[model samples]
Target: MVNTKYARVLDHPESSIRWDQESPLTMTVETREGEIETRYGRFVGGPADGVEVVEIDTGVMRVVVLPTRGMSIWKIESKGIRFGFDSPIAGPIHPSLVPIDDPSGLGFLEGFDELVVRCGLESNGAPEHDEHGNLVYPVHGRIANLPADALSIEYDEASGRLELIGEVMEARWFAKRLRLKSRLRVRAGSYRVYLLDDVTNELSKPATMQLLYHINIGSPVLDDGAVLEAPIEELAPRDELSAGEIDEWNQFGAPQDNYVERVYFTKLCVDDSNETTTMVRSGDGSCGLAVTHNVNHLPYFILWKNTAAKSDGYVVGMEPATNFPNKRSFETEQDRLVTIEPGETKSFRLSLLPLINEQAVNKTSERIKSLSETFEATVHRQPKAGWSDMS
Candidate 1:
């Protein structure tokens, strides 16, 4: 029988053993399926200097995880198909370089180029300011900018499961104290990557929170005529600009100059097990990517289409969130905020499957179609009240 192995990659409080390219820490283990390799290293130059990265090669897929960026997934590649956007922002940028608290409160975009990034711990959505115009919460919260306090790797040879774990704390004096523990798992010879996250309240008093997973894709997997398919139960445009093309919400077009973004908020239909899947496929249906999650935890989804010029960031975002990405005050008004008592924890799970061929893409498309056939989806031509700020 095979055994489970564990290794400590980083412990900021206990040691300063950070790895660089010249001397990266790597571990390879033999499993029944094949060989699994994990490497830990830090970027040395450019905007990504001092950024810690963990890369896992599962034979079928390769995933790059950023421990210094709230355990976000930088990129994923399987069978020569890359799954990430090419943003103008040359990142994995170090948190120090991002002015999250700038005057305009839009500094969060300075480093937002990840394939998957978490959007909460305290407040998410739009930036918030007080009556005096003082910034209270920066855009998309602070979790993405907070570095992990500890990181480790675990491998179960028998099951051929490999996992990278990280812990990030978002705490302060006289305010909310939350901890995010994230685990990224992959199995040898599999084209799927799984994420398990636990957000815990560490304060003596109860606290409220918001969370959203910003999963983005661009280029090859998201080209002209590409389509987004999901079992949407209820759907509404985010604003009037988006409402103009509500009929074509699921469709994508070629990148254009001066293209404005369109957003759609949706409540999805789930299966008997409370699970649902969303997918984006190439124009010819030759390749695609799918996201699977449990609806019991993530009750809302947002589709962001920004098909701008290549140099201006041509990308689409498939977000599964606890609540809509509105201002904290607006979300609170709509009663979309989540509250946790002291010592309590909330868990979230998500999986990404790369459809490497036409057959795989068709199979997943049929599954979504079957699920959607269960109910007639409601499509709102305009932004709906209580769901959109403009409404």
Candidate 2:
């Protein structure tokens, strides 16, 4: 490896070092424990685009987390303080291989000039076991928050208490598009998204309640081969479908020639391994994530990917959600529809459990049943024993 001593400081425990290389943003750090070393530190554009390298310790754990286009975390001052996550140059809005929106002729979803997901909130639906021992996936509601004037900025530096408190928002360093109102988590912590014209809304209910968020989970090591492992309890198939209608991934049919939309493997049990999902581009981001969680009320899960069509060999976009896309009206239903009466409020909490590929996928379901501490079914809906992954 070409090692060059770039001018920077290394903080211990929570120490960090940043280098403004000729290209992309790169940062490095060492844990206070001093046993961990991070390398391959980089930033990319959006959930489905370019990337920079991110590393920990001395190549111990590497990750390429960021978008493909607008490396906001790396390009803070370049786009000025007032930046948008819309990349008009990003082309179309289609997860071609999956059930992503085909927002063609209908015009695009106000893309980013550098194109990051521009919508205020983006959500995924999945299924699995809930905290109370119930089947879950595609939890209700989405994840996204915007302070009155949220900007796409970069993390000029990363260290202890990594954050920048703005007027209405707070930005953190050593993060993808490292700019967010620290206060955002205060209101958005519970996933109970709310909007009021008089409070934070620029206008009243307005014409539509439109919000789009590109929960970027980018990688910059795709050429080295990409591997994503997401586990769940069950993968259910959908019932009742209309011609050319949107259906679940497990229920998709054969495609004549063009690329097929996405296939969703629903209701998989979020066992120990299932909870250990992570994004790896090439060899970067190796064991960068330890665990994850669910934000919605449901426990189901959905996986997203950017297949062969993607240009960069160093980028990957994989996500596990709770429900299907555009299924807002389906909330609180037997499947996943919200049943709220007049002026009702609800909250959802989700966490993450990142693990290595070998630990996440190699282990079989038998191991889960054997290791399961407390396994119970609160809602014994007749197991739909049908739906499966089409891809």
Candidate 3:
């Protein structure tokens, strides 16, 4: 059996090693199924300049992780298919270039081009202003824009398991002190990627937090006739525009000019193990993507559809989050926010599986159908009271 190996790529508080593309750090290991390789490098120019990335090749899949940007996933490539949207903004824009604190509170969009990005530690929703009209929290919070303080790669050749670990801290004087420890894991020859995250309250006082995983997909997998399948317990349109087309909430169409976005909030049914699966399949049901997470940890789900012109970001989001992406004040009033005392930690787990063939897609769809049979779904044509800001 081959032994396990570990390498530290960055340690902000200790080491001062500056990484760049000129000379990258690389590692390779042979597994029973195939070779697993990892490369650590920095982007050279453009909006992504100076950003550090770690690319992992698990034989069957290629994933890029951005250590310089809260360890968010840049993209995933499986069987010649890319699972990412073509954002108008040429990103992975460096965090330095993102004006996250702009008065408009929409500065987060400046660097919003990732297949998977975390939205929280404190807040993860619309921007909120105080009674005095001063911005209290910016859009989507600040977790995604924060860089990891430490990063490491661990590989177990015997089991063909590889893990990219990162630690990001969101702390300041007289403010919330939180730390996010994230691990992205994959196995040799596997199309599924797993994420495990732990948010810890490092301060001596109690803290409130919110977290949401914004998983976006586009193009080939999100074109006309694509559909979202989930064992939904309850579903509600986020607004009147979305309510008007509630019947088409699960369906996708060809990109259209001047297309408006719609959002659906839902509570998903869980299996015996408290796990739930949500999928987006191609028009012919030939291939797709699946997101699986435990409902116990993430009780709410949000579907964001923006099928605008291709150049204007024709994409969809399958988000499994702790709560709906409402303003922090609103979520807190609804008791959807999480609170942790000093030295406390809360954990979350999720997996992404790329369906590379027709059989895989069909199998996943069947599983969701079976789950659906166990629970009756409630579909609300309009925004449900207590679930939406407008409501």
Candidate 4:
């Protein structure tokens, strides 16, 4: 297989050769260039000369970048520890087309906390840009464009911080077109994205566009031990009419053992102390997950999962969105969607915090239990008569 040369390095490494090991061919790849000896895997309908599978094992994270027919991609895995490989941080550098679920309809990146979009207005056979790059939906005779993805990505050896930059893609009407700069710090165990609205021409348009961070938590992170704790009250759907059945339990704390989906336009105050919303994932609470949102802009949030028989139920797709499922003003033959006028935009920020033990979850767990008790006492109290039967 592909392991003949890699055998030597696998058993013994000179320094630290970030590497790869996969089966069928059983190939291996290390960062430090040696004989560069190897056999290759067939990348489907690619050229006769196949591509190399790169595994970036930079301690804090082991990112695997591979090229496929669907999307040229990169999968990030935690280094030293190999438990975090089930998810992918999919990439699209500018004119990107990837992990293409269905090049049409409402499909997005499969596994990623970030996506950098660029230039384009029309979508799904809709009219966005004209022959020359003039906006059909001009706010003031101008078209907002998205930036090229991947301005640069820096991986620090000492601290293990990944400084990443994704330029803006375009938006309709007059909004800013600026670069989105952010950093993924593994030690800090956090990621933050700054919305840049410093584009020329449309500075007067007063930069505006909707942005959301979609993350999938592979729970085991959500077994019976997991508990949901957040500062939310009166969680409502931006599309109150459409939220329908899913909106039934919007304001309550959810159990990790049960299946659920819904959104919340909450009233929970997030002072600095309440900056974290956590999920305790094991029975004894040895590990957990936490997420913090840019509460200012993403006042609206969505918690959805297609876990019925049709879709697998291993992980939960908890999306902290900036707006509703559909934009405010998108009208279809079936329904009228809300829309923003010219020169308008929206943005949001959030962090995926990992709380890794019982100590981390103790306070968070108590907070959730107290809130759940209070909510049940108010909304789901016992009928006085039922209590009388015991008497």
Per-residue alpha-carbon lDDT of model 2 for 1-391, expressed as tens digits?
Answer: 4443332222111212333343222333232323322233222223322132232222222112122222112111110111112222342211221122322211122322221222212123322344574433222111122222331212222221111122222122331121223211101011111111111222222111112222333222233333443343444323222112222221212212333334333443454433323223223333222224342333444443323233321122233333344433333233443333222323333322223344442342233344333544232122233232111
Q: Kindly list the per-residue Cα lDDT of model 4 for residues 1-391, writing each as its tens digit.
A: 4332231111112212222343321222232321111222332221211323333233333333222211112233332211221322212221123222232321233323221221112221122334575433321111112223443344444443443333333443543343333333232233222222222223443333343344444434544434345545444443333145333432222233444443333334355443325342445566555556555655544444322221333344344534433422231321321133333433335555445556766756665455444442222122122111111
In candidate 1, the residue pairs with backbone N, CA or C atoms under 3 Å apart (3 or more residues apart, or in different chains) clash, namely none
Q: Arrange candidates by TM-score, highest first: which order?
A: 1, 3, 4, 2
lDDT per residue, candidate 3, 305-329, as tens digits? 9999999999999999999998999
| Model 1: ten consecutive residues of lowest lDDT | 8-17
The TM-score of predicted model 2 comes to: 0.39
In what order do the candidates fall by lDDT, top score first? 1, 3, 4, 2
Error of 1 at 322 (Å): 0.5
| Model 1 agreement with the true structure over 86-132: per-residue lDDT tens digits | 88785778999999999778999999989999998788798989999
C-alpha local distance difference test of each model: 0.87, 0.27, 0.87, 0.33
Worst 10 residues of 3 by lDDT: 8-17
Candidate 3 segments whose C-alpha is farther than 4 A from its true place:
1-25
lDDT of 2 at 60: 21
Q: Against the correct fold, how does model 1 do in TM-score?
A: 0.94
TM-score: the better of candidates 3 and 4: 3
Give TM per candidate.
Answer: 0.94, 0.39, 0.93, 0.51
